[model samples]
Target: MEQILANGVYLGSQYAMIALGLTLIFALMNVLNFAHGQMYVIGGFVTYTFYGQWGVPFVLALFMSCVTLAILGALIERFLFAPVIKGSSREESTMLLAAGIAFFLDAVILLVFGEKQRGVPKIVDGVFNYDFRLIMPYDRILICVLAILSIVAFIGLMQYTKTGRALRALAQDRTAAQLMGVNVDRYSMIGFALGAMLAGLVGGLLVTITGVNLGMGGPTSIKAFMMVMIGGAGVISGAIWGGIILGFMEAIGLALLYQYGDITYLLIFVSLMIFLAIRPQGLMGKPWG
Candidate 1:
């Protein structure tokens, strides 16, 4: 049970990292970015190429991958989201464009990578032995620590930094924020860049935990969307809570179903449906007026 709990927390941290990025983008943009999972996968591939193939240090590879994706995200925001936002049909256009971009990227990846599952070398080897016979991987512990730090840093930025304040202002009301001298376009680009960087970081860590392949992004994206919906669309705290809840639920659900010889995917779908039905706005979501 102790080991199970430890594993759950570790997995929860990973899920939190991915879900936080989704939450941030959705909170400010009010659009679900279907391309996020692809970004995550691309980050892992970038890390693998830089670190594994080019022999760069793991930390440096992670940094470079994030930076590269951040730039890509800025470009995407400028070219793809900008026109959609300015057009007459805002929501529909934005959704369709993002989804199309996601599909196109996925196809490109499939052609390039050829559906091979590949894992990155662990950042840290060996396990930490806890008192009472509990053993946990040092890398997983690092993930949990990083997760906490990332959340703290993000919160601190939002609460204390000028740019963060501008982001919050834009999130609350774009027109009002623009009138108040916030550069809406620049801020939106920055927010999207940060979101992409977070996805990249999580992707690098994910490669250490599980092998990556072209097809993995789709399921992960579905799970992330479910988590964002369950947590609330526009609330950071909601994302955090929803991520942890879903992570533990998934872990426990899989364990139980394994004992009963039931299908894991079915359980996941059923739980998602139940959550959607019970709280359409999600647990921490404010009702849309």
Candidate 2:
């Protein structure tokens, strides 16, 4: 039971990382960012290419991957999303553009990396035996610690910084923010870059835990979307809570379902669907102050 809880927390953190990024972009740009999964895989591959292949330090490699993706994300926004975000239409345009971007990135990475699985060398090797039934891995522990720290830092940024204030204002109301001289364009860029950086960071974290493959982006995107929808469509806090719910549900389902672990998502999604039908506003979506 303890091990399952631990796994839930670890997996939940990962889901939060992805869902957080997704929520940021959606809040500011009204775009779902289907390309995020590609960014995630790219982050892992970038870290691997540097640390696993080029002899760079693990920490440096992670930083490099994040920097690389951050730049990529910014450039993408500058070129593609900027127009759509400020234009008359939204839903279809953003989805089409983002999907195209996703496909392009996926193809490029597939051509470069081929069909191979790459793993990050265990930076912190070994396990803790909390007795026979409750052993835990250092990597998993590190992931949880890093996740908590990241969440705290993110909250601090949102709560205590000028930029954070601007972001919050925009998230609350873009037109009002623009009226208040909030430099919506600049903050938009900042939000996208931050979201992409988080995506990249989680990618590297995934590599550290279980390696990465070429075809991870699609499912990753789905998981992020699920978290966001379940928690609340546009609420930042909802993403975290949604991720925890999904992670815990997934863990519990896997434990109980055993060999039929794949059924976990089906069951959870059904439950979420029923819940959402009753409360379309999501857990933290509506009634915002």
Candidate 3:
């Protein structure tokens, strides 16, 4: 039980970081970024290259991952999304664009990184055990702590910073925010970049434990979407809640998997479908205006 709980917390923290990026982008642009998982994979690859291959320090490699993804995100928003958003009359167009971007990123990742899985050397070498019941690797603990700190820092940024305020205003009401002199285009790009950066950061942090591969992108996005839906789409706190809930569910399901076999995921997803059917707006989200 203790092991399960610890696993839940560890998984929840990392999952929340992934969900946060998706929710932030959704809140700001009303766009579901299918390419988000690709961005995460890129982050992991970047870190793997610099830290695992080039022998750079892990922290610097992580920074490079964040920088690389942030630039990619900014460019994508400026060149692809911004124009489509301005020209399109139908929201479906944006969704299509997102899908296209996802495919493009997948192709790029495969071409550049190949199909092989990649992992980094453990940053810390040890284990933490409490009464032999709650045992975890030292590196996982470090990553979990960093993930939590990153989330808290993000929350603080949203609540206290000027950039965050502008982004929030834009998210709340684009027309009203524009009327009040907010630069919608500038802030939108910034928000998207920030969202991508968060994804990269989490990818870098988890690469030590999970070891990223090119194929993980689609499933990662799906799981992130599940977390977003569980908490409430486009709601930050809801994303966190959804992540933690899904994390615990995964932990429990895995624990039962040996006994129950494939029914574990079936049950978990079915429960989510039922919950969404009952409350489509989600736990914290209001109906779209």
Return the clash pairs for model 2, or none. none
User: lDDT by residue for model 1 over 38-84, one digit each (tens)?
Assistant: 98998888888788778899889889878978998899998889878
Ranking by lDDT: 3, 2, 1
Model 2, 175-234: lDDT tens per residue?
A: 999999999889999889988988998898779887889889999999899899888976
Candidate 3, residue 238: CA error in Å?
0.7
Residue 40 CA error for candidate 3 (Å)? 0.5
Q: Model 3's lDDT to the true fold?
A: 0.93
TM, every model: 0.93, 0.96, 0.98
Can you give the lDDT of residue 170 in candidate 1? 86
lDDT of 3 by residue, 57-91 (tens): 99999999999999999999999999999999788
Instruction: Tell me, by lDDT, which candidate is best.
Output: 3
Clashing pairs in 1: none
> C-alpha displacement of 69 in model 1, angstroms?
1.1
Better of 1 and 2 by lDDT: 2
Between candidates 1 and 3, the lDDT winner: 3
Residue 248 in candidate 2 has what lDDT? 90
Give the worst 10-residue stretch by lDDT in candidate 3. 256-265
